[model samples]
Target chain A: MKETLKLFKIGGGVLDDDAQLHRFVQAFAQVPGRKILVHGGGKGASQMLSDLGIAPQMVQGRRITDAATLDVVTMFYAGKTNKQLVALLQASGVNALGLSGADGNVIRAVKRPVKDIDYGFVGDLPANSVDAATLHTLIQAELTPVLCAITHDGHGQLLNTNADTIASTVARALAGRYEVELHYCFEKNGVLLDVNDDNSVIPQIVPAQYQQLKADGVIAAGMIPKLDNAFAALEAGVEKVVIEHALNINEPIKTVLCRS
Target chain B: MKETLKLFKIGGGVLDDDAQLHRFVQAFAQVPGRKILVHGGGKGASQMLSDLGIAPQMVQGRRITDAATLDVVTMFYAGKTNKQLVALLQASGVNALGLSGADGNVIRAVKRPVKDIDYGFVGDLPANSVDAATLHTLIQAELTPVLCAITHDGHGQLLNTNADTIASTVARALAGRYEVELHYCFEKNGVLLDVNDDNSVIPQIVPAQYQQLKADGVIAAGMIPKLDNAFAALEAGVEKVVIEHALNINEPIKTVLCRS
Candidate 1:
């Protein structure tokens, strides 16, 4: 039987560990589907740029990417992130085509100023701009699409974006064609109900419980954004999401989130 | 009578037409100093990248830059050719400094990769890492440092470079020092040189030369690289480079090169 088509969201946490990324690429090469890999270059890029005398400014953790920062980010994301991922996947025998949202008009976006405050060079991706025909061509060629968080204004200019959001939008664009699954992978052992306790695991979150947790503050702190995006995917029509604990790398377990 | 520190570069030909690059970011703000800018983009990046899509794999001109394309050239010369120009002049009136061969611990270069082989990133600059002192403290204080085409290897990550390399490099690094002079303002009347007339009475290159002659003959296409970079600087640099004709941008034009 053929396996399900999946849309994987490789998190910043997974990218933080180079070794795990290497191993994950190995296993992924052995898998199926017209896989689209999207990545986040958090801390890594900002830190390097900072060390080089750049202090990042953002309205809400969203970097106010002007021109200089854009150049640096391009080096990190397009030049470093995508390149490394391509190298790793290629090493593992995967035919991966690394790309930016700008190439071949693959994905286009509108420059978004931050909440009425100009974020200089930041952008918001439009749903219609996600060109599915271009993507189909790549999949038909049997090449894996490894993407970075950066995009373009389509006039030869690039924009900074949240990688996870990019993956979500991409998944949303590509749903229903196949058994599309967006795997949000991180370095944790799974979603932990109790933060302090490592062994505690929350196997699933149904629609009602997902809402209740938000009401009762069971899911407060940082988990808010992740869950919000997870649910956004569910609402957008992806088959389901597997928020797995990618700690061991080899032995990945599914902490599924079903909408019911 | 001493005047302002005016920057003047001789573009390939495009700047001849687009003299608007010179007046873009308020030239009155430049700190009082002597200036002469020499630029080259060869008009290759646009046509060349486009050509590579169709041409055979010729190692020198047609080979596509893989993740490996950036290895040597992106880091080192990106600054030398592109970003440094943007980072250096883009906020001139507002204190965007200049950078080039003479700056403190600037661009370091690694040798070209093996002719046909992928060379791991090369080129060495004095400070691969931009120190807080340069981007933040220094420029904010109203000292304009004009950087020629160059970048550093920060921590041994040497890079190949091109002129007008880091187009928006300066703008992003020093967003606070907003204004910039990226593409086009030059001494020449713009790209207007005689293919056969050689009388040189035009006083400088003009826009007409950019379109008319380009189609007629190759016009020693090697000169295309320099002009190519000047155009990129507008988008890459914090401000716009007023690329004009070479003869009048500044005084004391380097006679040998111009008279060639």
Candidate 2:
């Protein structure tokens, strides 16, 4: 197979619905090359968790997973989300394994906060500690690595993070990692022109307009940071940044947040 | 209010299934006492785990949790399952929080094996190293304790132990520490004569009958061990062990596994 695209960043929406998540995973397994799927939880996990009386806090758009929240987030996002993705790939005849940040020194980071704000444990990756080589070995064995969006900061703490950040960083960590296509799968059709209207799909977004949409308040409620993520991922050396629907990932919008 | 039960053992089944899990937890909350819930996975966890290509391993009827299995198991059984149960309880107007065997020295164990078979890092409680007093203060602040069925040996290794075993041990650690009432929740009716036939519910079985059933294969396979657990719990000084449906745990198994 031609050098495989190494990273796929799936949004929280895609991870929420079991059926959609299973399908997205199946597509990745069919594609030729090494691939890792990184996902987050949409309102499905957040709302239920909130309804359960726990408010989710975020620092720099990543979840601040406290001890109480870590328990829920790990179960919902790490175990349930990660394992289910692996299951779908497996069911589709793909060899895959579900893992956490603690599996084999896979991903490490240091908890980061907004200085004065108390957003529990969110992390910034350690200096070049992500060993994508070992992951490649696993990939060589034909096993797809389904990793959760969490990191261990080495100082006796685990950190909740953005799946987009995790996926793109993993891509940057490997040599020739740039060939990996960074895909952001969500419930909608990429970033929309008018965020107030779900049906007004943008079809494409550039770095400049993405910021403009945020300034206009149309994207502020939800879609802003996610698109910024798609932007940041491209900035971090991913070959292509694709924003698409989980139901129909075959048709992706060219939301290039950066110039290659 | 009466002094609350010191340690609550949360069954994993109660964690994943929120609807059923919430009702049962609320009943405990209304008991006018401090309490803790130690939980395990319902069928969702085990099935999902197998989905990730991690086969279930057991020796002497206890989980032989390996590293690969342990990583996923910790996230699933302890991390995820424990949190969901607490969240559900807290959502249903119960101030619930989760604690694991690894958290704050709550559960201590060693990398133990079953009958000298080397079981990797499955936690143990030994005589008693758990500090229930610290947990008591949290409950006194109106928080419900939800625990995972994991513990550490004196070493830093995480251990994989049976939820029943975890529950029993935690209860024992709390026997004289606090006035504790222990309940065992599962999907099926309390110990049956033949699991193949649910109507063959034993209703009541004395030690001699239990022993005879084990010899006669009537209480064979998994049943004998479960009954043994019930007996062991009684001997360890738990006021009572009720094997009831997790959904409606208000009524316990009156058959009572204890001395007359």
Candidate 3:
């Protein structure tokens, strides 16, 4: 039996608010066993860009990560937010080591190939992108890696990547050595039965039930892609995937997705 | 017999200029041995602060690292500059891993105590600040750690430290395990005999010679503190302390300080 490794991802909602971010860090520190925290870029980067007279370019609803934008976001996510989170976790007695994918060549990504629209400096993860062996060494050394949503192409390019994709890829890659638990933590309690009802969280979700939930229109449209990625990770040998509130990670009132 | 470890430090002049920084990284990647790079904050951080409308506050001669300044410097040093250097080094075939002292608890520092003046958010490293054992492991792993001058109080506060101090402390700490060589790379070719003559480079300087040169006013007044620190490291068992030009590491025109 392999040791349990919990991987938690926190998105922009919790990251944008200082009070909420501190609360989440406190809760995350309390999570027992070896763990890693993957954080998404918050509104801070965009705000900095606008403040610096740089207008964000978007096409077909997807933001374009140009050269200037990549520089700002890299500073914000990998620099300010990542170091702050690591400091806070350290204050709470957690031995957290912050990382950008470029740090140890831990996650080498490819620049998203231009198709209909050019995504400037955005990166996409391919097979064998995550360096699981190095991560295993860091974890076995008792360091919790706090990863930001920034990676690099091996040949000198730092590319911005989606945090969710990074989390799932890392979990799947590490599954060979550990029982991986991928947690998606956000504002909501769990996968909701009704979008308006905060208390309508389903306790557990399986792939079969997840398919039925999608057919019945119970799951939100925005959440479908996340769940699809989660299920795909489960298929790829990740032991479990959980969706819960960032603040309520230690609680039981959450949704767990299993292979069943 | 212990293996040799080369620790190089680059300050503001090289770091502020992109072309110069690239040249330095290229030269650094070619250095053959276990190595580490320590980088100082450039004018970019202050430029960002000024661009964002934060006037820098100076107490006496030293700049105060207020909360806002700390944030910008952290992002600039750890985020933009560190990652850029890492990417560039990786491109040049060096396995460079960027780190703030907070990462891996590699260097823990104490907040500069309030004395005649309070330098807010500034850190001063004391004895045993650098975790040499962990660094040894990282070097043994064939990873060149690219360190920024950002550290944390083990209790959670991220503090801005002097890059030169960080390099010296790291070199001294690792002295017991390796034949450590500390290199301070700047704009000049080396310690010069004539202030106006770049070609009058002192190829070597021993402690007795350094004292006589200082007595005769051959060394510039500004180079005193840096040379003092360099000699101090030589005293602390670091095998050699080299004062060289950032872009001329591969060349032989530099000063080497020795115990003899």
Instruction: List TM-scores for all candidates, in order.
Output: 0.55, 0.48, 0.98
Instruction: Estimate, for each residue in B33-129, the C-alpha lDDT of model 3 and write its tens digit.
Output: 9999999998898889998888988999888999989989999999999999998888899888899998888999999999988999999999999
Cα lDDT for residue A190, model 3? Answer: 94
Residue-level lDDT tens digits of model 2 in A1-260: 23756566677656666676667766676667667777765655675467446776776785566776765677666554554455445446555545555543467666774676666767777557576765665565455667777666544355677776777678667535336677666666666666556667766666677667777776746655666666665676656667666666665443444452
Winner on DockQ (2 vs 3): 3
User: What does each candidate score in C-alpha RMSD?
Assistant: 16.5, 16.7, 1.1
Q: What TM-score quantifies how close candidate 1 is to the native fold?
A: 0.55
Error in Å for residue B248 of model 1: 24
Query: Which candidate number has the best DockQ?
Result: 3
lDDT of 2 by residue, B116-174 (tens): 57676666556765656545544555556666665555333556666777777777767
True contacts kept of each: 0.00, 0.09, 0.73
The segments of candidate 3 whose C-alpha lies over 4 angstroms from its true place after superposition are none
Candidate 2: stretches off by over 4 Å: A47-64, A126-129, A193-232, A252-260, B1-75, B78-260
Ranking by TM-score: 3, 1, 2
Candidate 1 CAPRI-style tier: incorrect
Which candidate, 2 or 3, would have the higher lDDT against the true structure? Answer: 3
Error of 2 at A186 (Å): 1.7
Clash tally, candidates in order = 109, 22, 0
C-alpha lDDT of all candidate models, in order:
0.53, 0.62, 0.93
DockQ for every prediction shown: 0.03, 0.05, 0.80
